[model samples]
Target: RAAATSRRLSHSQYASTTSGGPLQEAFAKGALKPGLNVVLEGRPKQPNDVEGLKQCLAEFRQQLAWVERLDVTLGQLTNVVESVSQNTTDKDAVDPENDFQREMSFYRQAQAAVLEALPRLRKLKVPTRRPDDYFAEMAKSDQQMQKIRQKLKSKQEAMEKSEKAKQLRAMRKYGKKVRRSYKRDISMTRMWSLSEELRN
Candidate 1:
């Protein structure tokens, strides 16, 4: 009896706390009842971090105006689009299914980009060409490459030698068969002449 009374007191306290809401009015009218699945609203949201947002925007603007500024020409973009449109119109001239046309299209676009970019880079005073005295380090040492070439050459030579040997063996076998057949034919002819001479 005491436990039942404690539960009723707790339920009344919960009901009082949720009294003014539409859900409580629905419960009062016996239209809807609260269950374990029923969810209540959480606490209101906290204020946004305005200072942090300002700092982030300032940083973004600084980065955008950095030493290496990005410049996109509307004219160049339009030219590229026009070129693509023209290329598409001549689909019959260059097969759409062929990879050659696709590759060529990419090459032309890249060429145009390079042509446009070079002038801008020069204007910006950026180095557009490598120095004559610039030396590039190769992935493999000269000695290692030479060794690889030697190995490949030796393999090729071995293959050629084996092929020659095989051809020679086949020729010797064929020649031996031909010599035997010729010798047999000659002996038979000689025997025929001897038989004729005996009869005479």
Candidate 2:
């Protein structure tokens, strides 16, 4: 009997909490439903960080000023694909396999960019060409270059030697053939002279 009484009290406590808690208030206001599986929309919006935003804006302005001072920003280049599509009526002009038209469009765009950039760069006094006194370091060391050169020279020499040996062998074979023919001609002459004497 005591166990039954305690179980009833626990059930009543759980019922009270479920009925009078914040969830019940939400359900009463139609913000929550009993059986529907849906996301709640009554949550408050996140507060913005005003100080953090100000800091970010300040940093962006500094970066913009630096870029302006350097005058490195070329703004935006014209879209080659879009321009090609607009200028040409052929359906294949924009196709990737149509390399000629695509390449020509890119070339024209690059040319235009160079033409536009040169004047601006000149006005800003930016150096467009490398100085004559500037010297670039070679990618390969001098010793490595020398080894490559030696290897190429040895290979060429071997090729030339092989060609000369081939020519000599061919000449020797031709000389042997010539000598055999001359010997045959002498023997035939001798036999013919003997036969003529016998007939006389």
Candidate 3:
């Protein structure tokens, strides 16, 4: 029950508080440590999985504009979660596949906000050393990202098509109304001209 409530509050905070500037700045400045945290390491691997830790070194380079990359990373994280949901077999799963899904989602959202705050962290000149197992860790993250993306492809494309169809329908409806109004105006103008000629 508490977890569910926490999840709800996280959702509220995510859509509002952490979506803006100061919290992001704190992350960039590496100042707020007692607040929100999103730790994904040490998660139990799936039976078929071979990788060990997820997400490696987001090296905050001093001169680099890390914000854009961070934004992309967040988007990618969202895609990962979506792909997992689309591909999972929830019915036959061990505690049900949807179990922990909410928590994982909250994690990614929080991580995204924290990452957006990376600029201030960079500004603070936080010295972060690359992990000894950096390459392996990165390979794991890459593999997961790719796996999710591949799984996501078909569903994502279908969703895009649906969205496009809706947009097209709306546009066509608006266009039809505009065309009717335009035709009426043109006819009115012609009738006015004819009346003036008749009067002359």
Best by TM-score: 2
Return the TM-score for each candidate structure.
0.37, 0.37, 0.29
TM-score of 3: 0.29
Alpha carbon lDDT at 111, candidate 3: 71
Instruction: Please report the TM-score between candidate 1 and the true structure.
Output: 0.37
Residues 77-96, model 3: lDDT tens digits: 64546644766655222233
Local error of candidate 2 at residue 49 (angstroms): 30
> Could you tell which candidate, 2 or 3, scores higher by lDDT?
2
Question: Residue-wise lDDT of candidate 1 within 55-86, one digit each (tens)?
Answer: 98888875454226655333334443444456
Ranking by lDDT: 2, 1, 3
Worst 10 residues of 2 by lDDT: 66-75
Regions more than 4 Å wrong, model 2: 1-134
Count of backbone clashes, every candidate in sequence = 0, 0, 5
Model 2 C-alpha lDDT versus the unseen true structure? 0.75
Q: For residues 1-200, what per-residue lDDT tens digits would candidate 2 score against the true structure? A: 99999999998898877745666667767777556433466897998999999998988865454326644334334465555666656533466676875687667767776787778778868888999999899999999999999999999999999999999999999999999998998899999999999999
58, model 2: CA deviation in Å? 21
Q: Positional deviation of 115 in candidate 2, in angstroms?
A: 12
